[model samples]
Target: MKIGIISDIHGNSEAINSVLKNIKEVDEFICLGDIVGYGADPNYCIEKIKDIKCRCIGGNHDFAVAGKVNINYFNYAARSAILWTSLPLKKENLNFLSNLKRRIELEDNVFAVHGSPQDPLLEYILDKDTASFIFSKFNFKICFVGHSHLAGCFSFSENNNQVNYMNFSNGGCIEINTNKRYIINCGSVGQPRDGNPKASYGIYDLKNKAVNIYRVSYPINLTKSKIINAGLPRSLADRLSYGR
Candidate 1:
């Protein structure tokens, strides 16, 4: 099965639209959450995801918008954006966000979560120590997550019990070593923070046991204009091009 993995689509419909156009042949889509927040067009983006019927989970932003979590931990801009996103959302979309799960297991061995396994909706696995700890907490061979909005992989080799962190390369394809376990960050759809301006996504080919990362350039100006017009923080609009 070929699965398209997307996450942190924080309401930027343009970015997600570009990604959908780029990768259209996937068998199933696994969304890792943050379906709304930080950008404009929350309803539009939510509808797009709903139309596809992608398996999704609640993100921190999603929780905040759904009033499921406190926005106290968020910074000024993020808090402001979440507040802006909370209003004007459709009832169905709000319910979808409200009912989203934190984590899921697919294909028997593949685990999916919005955040780290240790803390499904919040903690980020940035370093080897955290990654090592996560490896011990989950029993799956392959774990996929999003939230950091950075595209990459962390692999723990069973042979040496050593770990390696690899950034996505050109063409963005990584060979999956079934003998070892891996934790992959599918990156962000609406807001990418990997220093790359393009939107990021991933494809997991279960048949080949390989993961392919992808990035698509969308109309940043369009989303930015929408954000500004929506009365959201201008910083929210400005950040799209910078990918901060």
Candidate 2:
């Protein structure tokens, strides 16, 4: 099965729409969350995801927007977006955000989470040590996570019991090793922080055992203008162009 994985789409409907247009012909879509925070058009983004029939998990931002969690935990820009999102989501959209799970186990033995497996709404497994620790806790051959908005993959091989980080620039297909395990971050659909600034997402083919990360261009200025027009914080709009 080919699954299109997306996460951290913080309400830039333009970027999300652009990414969706490129990823044609996938069996299923899996969203790792943050559908409503840090940008404009929270309701529109959530509606788009639902239209695409994506299997989603609630992100920290999603929880905050739903009033299930406190917004004090977020930063100034994120908190602003959260406050904005809380006002606009309708009853059905709010329930959709509320009903999302923190994690999902795909049929192909891959586990998906908005954040780390250890702490779904909090911890980020960035380094090898943290990745190794999380790998030890889960027996799945592959675990996909997103929160930091950086696209990368870490593989732990049982042969040497070592963890290795794969480079995105290589552009090679990653074969899931049955004896080993992997933690893959598909990056953000609306905001990317890995310095490239383009919208990042990936397609995973379980049958071919290959994963390909793709970056697509979007109208940053258009999204920025939307953020400013929505009365969201200007800093949030500024960051999208720089990808910081």
Candidate 3:
């Protein structure tokens, strides 16, 4: 099965639409969350994701927007987006966000989480030490997470018991070795922070045990204008071009 993986959409409908248009033939979509925060068009983005039949989990921002968590923990830019999302999310969308799970185990022994395996909404598995720590907790062959908004992979080779990291720039397939375990970050669809302005996502071909990291250009200015017009923080809009 070819599954499209997306995360941290952050309400940028334009970026989401561009990604959907670029990757048209995936069998299923797995979303890692932040469906309604950090940008404009919360309801529109939620409706679009539903229309595409995506399987998703709750993100930290989603939790804050649902009032399940306090937004005071968020940074200034995120707080602005969370407040905006809380105000405009339709009742149905709010219910959807509230019902989302923190993590999901795929049929092929792969796991998905918004942040990290240990704490789905709180921790970030950015370093090899953290990745190695997480590897000990789960028996799955692979764990896919998004929250850092960076497209990268951390693999623990059972042979050497070593962890290694690789960043993917262009979209391509990667074959998974059964002998080793992997923790893959599919990256952000709406907001990328690895110093790349383009939106990022990934495709996992379960049959072949391969993953492809994809990036697509979208109308950043349009999203920025919407963010500003929605009364959200201007920094939220300004950061899109810089990918910070």
Candidate 4:
């Protein structure tokens, strides 16, 4: 079976549509949250996820918009976007965000979380120390996460007692090693932040025991226009071009 992995889709319909269009066929989709936050089409994005029945977790932005997280915790631009996104959401869509779990365990010893396993919606496992520590917190052979919006992989080898990081910002593939545990970030489908403006996603081929990261271009100007038209923070729209 093949699973399409997506994360940090901050309400950019253009990005999500482009990603969905570009990824190869899969048996399922697993979203790492932030379905609505920084962009303009929160409802549309949520609806698309719902339509595909993607198994998703709640992101910090999603929690903030759902009133689960303190709005004050976010920075100015993110706070403004969250407040603006909350106003027009339908009742059911709000419920969807409100009810998302912090983590989900899938078949084949795979785990999914919005951030790190220790603090699913808050902590970031970006560096070596954190990745090493996080490796001790989960028992899954493969953990998929996305909160930092950077696409990458961190692997811990039991035999060598070593941890290695590989940047997948430009896209790459890896053959799963049975002796190593992995923490994979699928990157941001909407608001990529690894200095790449293109939308990013990942594919996990269970049968083949391999993972592929990919990046695709989308209609950025269109999403930017929507963000500006919605009266959201201009920086939110501007950041899409730089992916930072």
Candidate 5:
């Protein structure tokens, strides 16, 4: 089965729509969350994810907008976005975000989380040390995470007692080695931070035992205009151009 793995949608409807259209051929979709912050379309994104039956996990921003996390946890722009996002969200969408699980386990020893397995809603497993420590905390052969907004993977080989990080910032495919465990980040659909402006996603093929990261262009200017028109932070709209 080929599962489309997406993370950090961040309320950018254009980016999410483009990703969904591009990955529509996959058998299923799994969302790593952040579905409701930093962009201009929380309700639209939520409805779209639900419409496609995407299995989702709660992200920090999602929780914040749902009133499950303190707004103070975010910075000025983010907090403002969170407040703005919350006002327009349907009660059902808020409930959906509020009830989302932080972690979910799939078949084939695959696990999914919005953040690191240790702290699914908050932690950013960005380094070899953190990945090494996190490896001991989860038994899954592959743990897919999003929150760092960087497309990459960390593989730990028990035989060599080594953890290696590979950057897929430009998108690529990696075969899963049974001897090595992995922590994979599919990057972000709406708010990429790996210096790549294109929307990012992943296709995990169980039959082939490979994970393919992909980047695609979307209508960034449209999203930026919406952000500006919606009264969201100007910097949020500006950063979309730089992918920072």
Candidate 6:
């Protein structure tokens, strides 16, 4: 089962469209969430994902737009985006976001969540201890997560009882080892903060037992212009280029 895993789309249809073009062969599509948030075209992104019936969990932004979460939890800019995003969304899309699960566990024991499984919609597993804690919480060997907008993988070695974290900033991959456990972050599509500025996503190859992180250079300016045109913060437009 070749799975196309995408996350943190943040309403950038340009990025989503570009990313989808690169992975058309995958048998299944799994979206780790944030289908709408900090860019333009929220409705399009939502409709696009629904068109494919993407297996997606609810992201913080998604919940915020659906009024399931308080905007107080987000920064002012994000809160503004969410508030603005809510205004134009169709009732069906709002219901769609509302129906999204906080976490999804595939039959093969693959877990997908907007954040870490421990806190599904909020925790940022950025260090070893966090990773260790999350790995301990889930019995599954591999879990795919979004939310920090950083593309990377965390590996736990039972022999040493240690967990290590590294970024796939340069677009690297891991040859999945069944004897070990993994926490893979699929990064952000709409807004990438890995310092590379490229759109990031992942591929999970079930037959070969491997996970690959891939990057594509989308039209950042187009998204930037859209953000600016929509009256979103300039900082939001600026960050897309810096990937900070």
Best by lDDT: 4
Please list all clashing residue pairs in model 2, or write none if there are none.
none
What 10-residue stretch in candidate 5 is worst by lDDT? 101-110
**Cα TM-score per model:** 0.97, 0.96, 0.97, 0.98, 0.98, 0.97
User: Which parts of model 2 have CA positions greater than 4 angstroms off?
Assistant: 169-172
Worst 10-residue lDDT window for candidate 1 reads 167-176
Q: After superposing candidate 3 on the true structure, give the runs of residues whose Cα lies further than 4 Å from its correct spot.
A: none
lDDT of 3 by residue, 1-244 (tens): 7999999998999999999999967999989988889888899989998998888899999999999878888998888778878887789999999999998878767889998988999898889999989888877788999989988999988999999988764445567997889999878999899888899989888878799998899999999999898888988899999987
lDDT of 4 by residue, 1-244 (tens): 9999999999999999999999878999999999999899999999999999999899999999989999988899999989989999999999999999898877768889998888889999889899998888777899999999999999999998799999999999988998999999989999999999999999999999999999999999999999999999899889889989
lDDT of each: 0.88, 0.87, 0.88, 0.93, 0.92, 0.89
Kindly give the stretch of ten consecutive residues in candidate 2 with the minimal lDDT sum.
Answer: 167-176
| lDDT by residue (tens digit), candidate 2, 148-226 | 8888899999999999997553234677777788999878889888777788888989888878888888999999998
For model 4, the local distance difference test gives 0.93
- Per-candidate alpha-carbon RMSD to the true structure: 1.2, 1.4, 1.1, 0.9, 1.0, 1.0
- How accurate locally is residue 122 in candidate 5, as Cα lDDT from 0 to 100? 87
Please report how far candidate 2 places residue 222 from its true position, in Å: 0.4
Compared with the true structure, the alpha-carbon lDDT of candidate 6 equals 0.89
